[model samples]
Target: MVLEPIYCPSCTSTNIVKHGKSTQGKQRYKCRNLDCSRSTFILRYSYLGYLPEVKQRISEMAINGSGIRDTARVLKISPTTVIEELKKRS
Candidate 1:
């Protein structure tokens, strides 16, 4: 069996344990990094889109003068998503 690399989106910590399943039957994982802000995470699109890496990329692209529409197009996400991410960073 292939082992999946589970990481804490907040701190990028791979020290994680199976937390349980979500109500929707998704696999949940708890981060072992005490310094991490996020406690648990589910490997899903909705959650993945909100990961720190994604957020950082959003900021980087924005700072590089990328428009929200262009960022969304390149990121394969929604412009609303780009806007929301920028809002959070600001």
Candidate 2:
């Protein structure tokens, strides 16, 4: 079996521990860094829209003149998600 090293998304600290399971049954992790702002986070997100990389890509696609429907199709996410991300940026 391969062991994966989990890091805190906020501080990128490897000092973390298993907190509990989210309502969606995803594994939750707690950051042990005292200076870290975020307390708990999930390593794997079921929704593509919730991932930071996807959000960044959405912004990049928009900047490159991709429409909402095109961005959604390329990212395999909802057009509403693309719209919301753009709204948040503005």
Candidate 3:
């Protein structure tokens, strides 16, 4: 078996542990690093909306004059996701 190293996305620490499965059944991992702000994360997200980076992009696209549909299409996420994120910012 090829052992792949798992690193915490928040702190880039190798001290990771299997936390549990996400609602969608993705393998979730936890960072053992005491300074980590993130609780749990999956190495690969099945949905674009689940990624923090994508959420940031959603905010940026909105500020940069991209419409909801435009941001959804560009980011390949749901229009509702874009709208929800924008709503949270306000």
TM-score of 3: 0.87
What value does the lDDT take at residue 42 in candidate 1? 83
Model 3, range 1-90, lDDT digits (tens) per residue? Answer: 899899887889999999989888989998888899987889999888979899999998888899999999999989999999889988
Candidates by lDDT, descending order: 2, 3, 1
TM-score of each: 0.69, 0.78, 0.87
Question: Candidate 1 lDDT, tens digit per residue, 54-75?
Answer: 7788899999999998888887
Model 3 pairs whose backbones collide: none
Predicted structure with the largest TM-score when compared to the true one: 3
Distance from true position, residue 6, model 3, in Å?
0.6
Q: Which of the two, 2 or 3, has more TM-score? A: 3
User: Rank by TM-score, descending?
Assistant: 3, 2, 1
Of the pair 1 and 3, which is ahead by lDDT? 3
Instruction: Write candidate 2's Cα lDDT for 1-90 as tens digits.
Output: 999899888799999999999999998999999999988889889999988789999999989999999999999999999999999998
Better of 2 and 3 by lDDT: 2
Clashing pairs in 2: none
Overall local distance difference test of candidate 1: 0.83
* Candidate 1 vs candidate 2, lDDT winner: 2
